[model samples]
Target: MKKIKCLGLVWLLASGLTGFAKDYPVSSAKELSALSLKPGDRVLMKAGEWKDQQLKFKGNGVKGRPIVLMAANAGKTVLNGNSTLDIDGSWLVVDGLSFANGRLDSGEVVNFSEKSFSCRLTNTSVIDYNSSDDKVDYTWVSLRGTHNRVDHCLLKGKNHQGVTMVVWLSEKPNYHQIDHNYFGPRPELGRNGGETIRIGTSTWSFHDSFTLVEENIFEHCDGEIEAVSVKSGRNIVRNNLFYECKATLTLRHGNHSEVIGNYFIGNGKPGTGGVRIIGEDHNVRDNYFQDLTGTGNSAAISVMAGLPNPILVSHWQVKNARITDNLILNCKEPFAIAAGYRKDRYLPALNTYFAKNIILSNVSPLKVYDEKVVVNFEDNLIFSTAFSGEKGRGFELRNEQLKKGSSGLFLRPGQADFKPFWESEQIGPGWFLDINKKFTIN
Candidate 1:
């Protein structure tokens, strides 16, 4: 009786009584759309170029059992030439696909719909997928909904205008995670709307995005001044590498965001900026800014002055900013206080605190635009080749010789043990091994 019962259970599982997951091999978009996918089901695309295909993958799966859409062979399936993907479901995963040699005439290349929750897009590549006309604006990736993630992807060569990736927010908080990706080589668009990543728009700036952007690399992404524009509240940008990118990660709107542990390596490039502050209660800490040449409003650290009684869409006064424990090495302008101050825009930063920072620069460390700006500095250190009895209210000058590390980074004595948090192997796809070959940390 026991042997007969065990055999009966096996037969029931095999005969689909237990709802076993299955894999469907699909060749065309029409074939893929015909199937109704369930949880733990996988739709595998054939390993070839799928051109001019508009794929809308819509399914609902519970937690721990996601519906997956992937290539039969990883990195071998390409969607090119007017191809786009719309993920409009919950707990879905899209992995190992490539979008190259293509341009979307309208809409985004990859869009997570407004109702897509707990969805993820991983190990994908969107390369050179731009419209031929630069004026025709279309985004590459549009992330919406809550708890969505875009990770381990390579997004590069976006020459046309529009954000490379955007996190669209609704009335509620969208907790998105954008990490471990490579954003590379977007040339100057010479206008606005060229940000590599924008969290929220001006209309949704007051909403709480709760987004986290970390462990990514921004290489030569000089589309506009703002590389990663934070326009929402309570977001975090941490542990990312900005490699020779001629732009600043601007907190353009919203409040109470944080920028932490990021490395900005300019390599003495022109117009290379670090971070720009324009909000309230934002914290910028534990970041390293090296070899940047941008000055004035594009300094390594800039705090913008606001307009009197500014509108919601305009610049707001930076209040209660905490800039702490940052390393500014060989930068042209280390700090720009009251950066955009003018006659019309005369409201300076208020109650800001700069504490425990290390500044090693050739020029003056601080550029105070207005005398009414209330900034408190405490326990900062300045390393200089010639001290000459330099003294300040909050800084101590030390004549120290800097030495270069094995990876061509100049460090002060006892600071040689500082290692980068994010590495090339930790970010991007495994097949793209040359992610950070140009900049290697010791």
Candidate 2:
């Protein structure tokens, strides 16, 4: 092992030139700790397994010249940190590594505590295979820092929860991005098993804001993808795939967030809904819901603004939200929304926009409560039928008046010509069945 103090500065300059790449091979974890890395310095970890070691780097890098710690080869390299990676520095990049078997009595495997600026962890795999206990080992990756990015990582474990990525306003870790990660298959026999990704403000009165989760895949999570309760705002979730999750996504109490371009499949367990929006000024659009079958209770989407019973007057105002351009198929029940104010306190009305969607194989397509709740619906296609002696139609809206027209019904191409029997409905597009395309959605 070669020890080089402040060698990061030299490597920083050499990183701009091709000659410096050969000299900066970080062969051991011990040498990685000794170097005072700066911006543009690239530390390459050789291909081998290094177990039960704690590697720490306490240095800062510039914006354009981030200090990078990546794999020397595209081969298998493991870091079995029996503790955690406490990232306390800024502007660092850790890429292309596999971290496993992190044994912490408590806390997260990767702890980003009280750091600022930005860090990127890409193309990494974190696996926890501890089957000895039935307790959740806190979070796999805890984000208490600002503007960090975790991308293209596979996080699998037998813990209570998968990821607790959060931000607090006072110690506010704002502008964080968690994208293209896979969170799934929590330990089957664990207690207190809950959300895959839990988002909330810090305990010390911190406000979280500007978080983005996109293009991720989540499966077999016992709880929802998100649990937000604080005054965080501007959170965006788009283009992700959810399967076998209890609740795909939920917004307890937040404002100005958006969920768009997502695929939700097989959510809602025995008695629940799929996507629950319980906040203010939220937007849900361009989503696809399919095959949500459980114990006789399922809704493609549910929105509830206010609190129920003992009713705090201001709790239920899920106001000024929009739901549009969605496709709901094979759902056990229709979609629903609820809004009301408490009698004790005076609250304002709730308004919504539901438009341009295709709903198939359900008893009802739209359902709402309270006459004062204004919901606008247009350009939606509804397909309903009764095979078991039940009266089913193309449209059903409960407790609310819906405006329907010819533009509202957008039948599929084959549906316009061929009416199949009740048992022969097509589940997906015809292009998926074509073998010559060389690609499929399955």
Candidate 3:
């Protein structure tokens, strides 16, 4: 076994870095963490391999200048947490490091406290080794902080899920941003793998809000994105790319959020689709779905009322939501939007808009499972489904046989603008889609 070396303090002090009160160079993660860190102190890990250790920080930093913890050189340093990194501080930054292959008895590798704010982890790579059972063996990064950003990183693993970033606002933590990352190719088999980014309301708090997930690449994971039971005021997920995954995105039991400007490709397995919506009001617009080919089952987009009866169907319901300005290409079945609460429960669709989208080269353009549900539809383009069983390019619901409403499947001129409806009011085009086509409203 190669022994790791601890660089001297003189080397770190002479490293010529400013904006800090003092600097500390650490050889081992345990030795580095044992020191008492203050508000303006900086800790630099020298170039070496660290193994089977947990690096923890329990310090405080002020608002203006944060305590900096980073690798000395870009690719020269490695933090091989054969265990994990538990962070319990505010305004700390970790950059330019590598986190690889660790055992997870607790199901988590990196855990953050709610009080940690404005922290950032960037330019890092997290790779996991294949286990005997072919699982990733741990959850990559577990979050519970506000205004924290994780960007420009590569996270790849097997068996367990990828990054499970959660917010516990009751503990005074909110506003997490996860952007510009790559996630894929878990070591495990079967579809038991979870999502790349799983955003859910923490059990500690009901006030989770203001989470932004964008510009990430998700490929070959069982489920790409899963947002479950988040009771927040504003959540934004946009401008992402999904390829060769089981499911693209699923939003369940959430209120007042926007899912737009995303690209979904090659998904559909049994109970999955490109985008699935259940619960409250949300804006699903300006997205692109293409080549969703698989054996199990898939749709471009599926919106259904939550489970009913004793389950207490989401009180707000799927109301005041807009689904427009999207393009669905080469799908097995394009749209599956249905109403009527699950299992004999009836729910009405109020102020819901499904308009100005383009569906091309699909077996059936639109498949409305239920008819009693009232949906406002207008100005959509459905190309070349005139000869198969339906006539005259219009919306087809409930297995291409039943048609409902006046604004059925038909080709229209341009897309609809859904920016005004978003909570954050910050809208942009998808990852690689044409921006000129996005701003032009029909």
Q: Number of backbone collisions per candidate, in order?
A: 0, 9, 14
TM-score of each: 0.93, 0.73, 0.75
lDDT of 2 by residue, 251-303 (tens): 55557888887766663344333566665788888786766652211356766
- The residue-by-residue lDDT of candidate 1 on 236-289, one tens digit each, is 999999998899999999999999989899988899999999989999998989
What is the Cα-based lDDT of residue 96 in candidate 2? 73
The better candidate by TM-score, 1 or 3, is 1
RMSD in Å for candidate 1, one decimal? 3.4
Error of 2 at 239 (Å): 0.6
Of 1 and 2, the candidate ahead on lDDT is: 1
Best by TM-score: 1
**Over 4 Å off, model 3:** 1-20, 38-40, 129-138, 161-173, 187-193, 201-206, 223-233, 267-272, 294-298, 310-317, 339-350, 387-442
On residues 1-442, what C-alpha lDDT tens digit does candidate 3 reach at each position? 1232234444444443334477888877677778887667878878878787678866777666677777777645665546567777888877667766655554566667667778877776666733434345456677677788787667665465444444445444368888777665542344434556666642322344678888776666654334223445467888876655665476555567788888776634333347766556688898877666531124677666533442422433456778998877667667765633455544545676778776776375656665666667677666645325433334432223222113222222333333221222222212212211222111
Tell me model 3's lDDT, rounded to 2 decimals: 0.60
What is the lDDT of every predicted structure here?
0.88, 0.58, 0.60
